[model samples]
Target chain A: DAGVTQSPTHLIKTRGQHVTLRCSPISGHKSVSWYQQVLGQGPQFIFQYYEKEERGRGNFPDRFSARQFPNYSSELNVNALLLGDSALYLCASSLRLGGSSYNEQFFGPGTRLTVL
Target chain B: LAKTTQPISMDSYEGQEVNITCSHNNIATNDYITWYQQFPSQGPRFIIQGYKTKVTNEVASLFIPADRKSSTLSLPRVSLSDTAVYYCLVGEPLPNSGGYQKVTFGTGTKLQVIP
Candidate 1:
């Protein structure tokens, strides 16, 4: 089975520009989450969507947002990109939301965003 | 979310066993400990998760003591491919905590498996 997949494998944007990254979850998965990984650090949670509803959010700024689609796909939007926004954006999918062991999330290769 | 603390890095050789420990002194009752491994440019891959005691899988073993204040991830006979960053995450999902449950990952332990 195909794992979670992300689009626009690499992107370059300038300050003040907006960018949207896409992700398609593994078939039958119903939850998607986003994270940002800067160089030499662990991924930081951004947002999580389950069953087409916003289930959770992280300490990200208001400029970051995400939503899950009917097909279980998700989109992460970052507005007014800052130099600090230049990091790898990751998308992960789980069979469902919550603490079930079966709900383990599988992540994608991620989209490398470079803010110029 | 329970904050975790792990070594910044570790070194091991082929055919050697490597154990990385994480401390979460303030872990909540509902929080479960999960570990993830990540290669360069790729997202983290789930390694193993455990609530308490010992949990073993084909890849590694997770050992949690009764106190639940700390856990250890043991990799047996690690190879060069096992060189990656290992993260320890602690949290529960769902309607609790303002319905915004999320895992906060700290700087992971970078394991370098030398040939």
Candidate 2:
């Protein structure tokens, strides 16, 4: 099966603008998650959605939001983008196993966002 | 959520076995240990995960002690392609949902495989 896929391979926006990143999970997958990885640092969790409901959120600010579609696809939106928002936005999909603490996620190449 | 600490970097020679250790001293009973590997400009890929004892896959092995305070990721026979950042993540279950939460991916261990 194909791996997790993300869109807008690269994007450039000015400060205070808004950006939306899209992702398509693998077939039969019901869970999707987002992460932000700044240069020279590990990826930070943003949000996760399963069964079309918001499941978990990280330490991100209110400006960030996400939603999962009926088909299991997901979109991540960041409002009032700051220069600090510049990073690689990654999308990962996984088959959730009940009663387990962790899900093995397959990630996409990521959408590189640059704010000037 | 439990925080994890790993080495900033490591150097390994090709064809040699490499082991990366992660410390989660504040781990809880519900926390499960996981590992991921990532290369430049790419998203992280799951390597292995385990709650306790030993878990091995075709790609690597995860060894967690009885205390569950720490875990080690063992990669058999180093190769040039194995050079990447290895992350040790402790997954915490959300209170409302059964899904796990990703709090932070600590400064991972950068492994540089040498020829």
Candidate 3:
């Protein structure tokens, strides 16, 4: 089976612009999470959706939002992109989420978003 | 979530057993330990996880002592291909700390295996 898949392998946006990144979870998976990875830092959590409901949110700004579809696919939107937003946007999927050992997330190759 | 501290980098030769330890001095009672491995331009892959004692998988072994103050990830007979970044993560955020749970990752330890 294919792992989590993301779209637009690379994206370029200018400051003050908006960008939307997409993700498709693996079959039978019900959870999708979004993360932002800086060049030299670890991925920071942005949002998590389970069964098309917002399950968790990170310490990101209000400009960052996400939603899940009935098909379990997800989209992460960043409004008024700032220069500090340039990083690899990663999407992960799992069977479910509630912490513990059951939350092993399978990640995607990531969508490299570059804000100029 | 508990904070983790690991060596910035480590170097080992082929066919050698490598053990990387992580320190989480402020761990909580319900927190579990997890490990992840990642290569350049790729997403992180789960290595092993353990609550206490020793847990071994086909890839590596995770050893958590009784106190749970720290943990060690041991890779047996590691080769050059095993070179990558290893991340030690504690459990999700506490209940009172908001419901924004996530797989928190720190600046992982970079392992360079020499052939």
Candidate 4:
């Protein structure tokens, strides 16, 4: 089975613009989470959705938002983007919302966003 | 969430064992220790996870002491392809009432495997 998949492998936008990144979780997965990774840093949690509802959010500002669909696909939106927003946005999928069995997350290739 | 501290980088020759240690002095009782490996320009991949003692999988081994304040990830006979940034994360397995599993990752240790 295919692992998590992300769309628009690369994106470039100007400051103050808006951008949307997409992710399709693995088949049979029920949870999707978003993360941001800046250069030379580890991935930081952004938002997590399970069962089409927002489950968790990170320390990001109000400009960042995300939603999950019934099919377990997710979309991450960033408005009024800034140069600091330039980074790789990763999507991960898990079996459920914090399932007790390990809850291992499988990540996708990620969408590299460059804010000019 | 607990804060983790790890080395910035490490270097080792091929076919050698590489050990990365992470310190989480404030780790909670319900928090589990997990490790992830990320290559440049790619997303992180889960390596191993354990609550206490030692847990070994086909790819790596995670050792957590009785105090649970620190953990070590051991990779046996690592190859050049194993070179990557290893992140140590501490978090609870269960989600909060809002249904979000809060996880925190550290700066991670970048491993350089020389052939």
Candidate 5:
């Protein structure tokens, strides 16, 4: 089975522009989560969706939003982007929403976003 | 949420064992200790996880004391390929409302293995 998959492996956008990144979770997985990793730093959680419902949110601003679809795919959108928004956006998938099985999040290669 | 603290970096030679310790003084009862390995330009890969005592897997071992304030990840037989950043995260297994564990990652410990 494939691991989590992300789209637009790399992206470049101007400040104040909008960007949307996509993710397809592993087959049979029902939970998708988004994270941002700045250079030389570990990833920070953005949002998480389970069964098409928002379950958790990070410290990100209102400009950042994400949603999951019926098939368990997810999209992360960032509006009014700033240079500080440039980072690697990662998508992780788990089998379900709770317990130890869900704690081990399998991540995708990530979409590298560059806001200039 | 529990906050994690780890060393900024570590240096080791091939064929040696490496132990990276993480401190989570504020961890809660429902939180679990997890370790992840990340290479440059790549997403993190799960290494090991444990709530207490010791848990060993093919890739690494997780050691947790009774107090649960700290945990250690031990990598055996280091190699140049093992050079990467290791992250320790503490969070509940259940999602809050957004469907995730509300995880917070620290700066991580960068391990460099010499040949």
Candidate 6:
């Protein structure tokens, strides 16, 4: 089966502009999560959606938002972008939202956003 | 969330066993320990995970002692292809279990495998 897939591998936008990144999760997966990774740093969680509902959100600002579709695909949107927002946005998929077992998270190649 | 601390970098020769240890002094009873490997310009790949004791997969082994304050990831006969950043994450897998559960990654250990 195909793994998680993301769109627009590279993006360049001016400051204060808006951008949207898309992701399609693996088949049969129901949870999709978004993460941001800056250069030389580990990824930071942004938002997590399970079964088309927002399950958890990170410490990001209101400018960042995300929604999950019924098919388990997700889109991350950032408005009024800042130079600090320039980073690799990663999408991860899991089986469910809550449980004791820690299922492995499958990740996408990510969309590199460059804010000029 | 438990804060994890790991070595910043490590060097190993080909066909050598590599072990990376992470210290999480305040890990909760329900938190799970997970390890991820990330190559440059790519997303992180889950290597292995364990709650306590020992768990082994085809690729690596995770050894968590009874104290649960620390964990070790063991890679046997590693090669140059194994060079990557290894992250140790300590968090509860459940959503909204305690306020909001977010996975916090440390600086990670950058493993350089020389051929």
The candidate that achieves the highest DockQ relative to the unseen native structure: 4
| Interface residue Cα RMSD of candidate 4 after superposition | 2.0
Backbone Cα, N, C clashes tallied per candidate: 0, 0, 0, 0, 6, 0
Question: Tens digit of lDDT per residue, candidate 1, span A34-76?
Answer: 9999999999999988899897888889999888899999999
Q: Which stretches of candidate 5 lie over 4 Å from their true place?
A: A100-102, B93-99
Give all TM-scores, in the order shown. Answer: 0.95, 0.94, 0.94, 0.96, 0.96, 0.96
Per-residue lDDT of model 5, residues B1-115, tens digit only: 6799999999999999999999999988778888999999999998888889999999999999999999999999999999999999987646344336676789999999999
Candidate 4 CAPRI assessment class:
medium
Candidate 3 lDDT over residue span B2-108, tens digit each: 89999999999999999999999888787789999988878788888888999999989999989999999999999989999999998774365334357788999
Alpha carbon lDDT at B25, candidate 6: 95
Q: Lowest-scoring 10 consecutive residues by lDDT in candidate 6 chain B?
A: B92-101
For every candidate, the chain B TM-score is: 0.94, 0.94, 0.92, 0.94, 0.93, 0.93
Write the residue-wise lDDT of candidate 4 on A3-75 in tens digits. Answer: 8999999999999999999999999999999999999888999998999989888899999999988888999
User: Worst ten-residue run, lDDT, model 2 chain A?
Assistant: A96-105
Looking at model 4, residue B76 earns an lDDT score of: 99
The sequence of per-residue lDDT tens digits that candidate 1 reaches over residues B48-92 is 999999999999999999999999999999999999999999876
Quote the true-contact fraction of every model. 0.66, 0.69, 0.61, 0.71, 0.65, 0.55
Writing each residue's lDDT as its tens digit, candidate 3 over A12-101 gives 999999999999999999999999999878888899898999988889999999999999999999999999999999999988766434
State candidate 1's DockQ. Answer: 0.60
Model 3 lDDT, residue B18, Cα: 96
lDDT of 2 by residue, B37-108 (tens): 999999998888899999999999999999998999999999999999999998776555465556468999
Question: Candidate 1 at A20: error in angstroms?
Answer: 0.8
Q: How many backbone clashes does candidate 5 have?
A: 6
Best by TM-score: 4
Of the pair 5 and 6, which is ahead by lDDT?
6
lDDT of 4 by residue, B1-115 (tens): 6899999999999999988999999987778899999999898999998999999999999999999999999999999999999999987557445356766778999999998
Better model by lDDT: candidate 1 vs candidate 2: 1
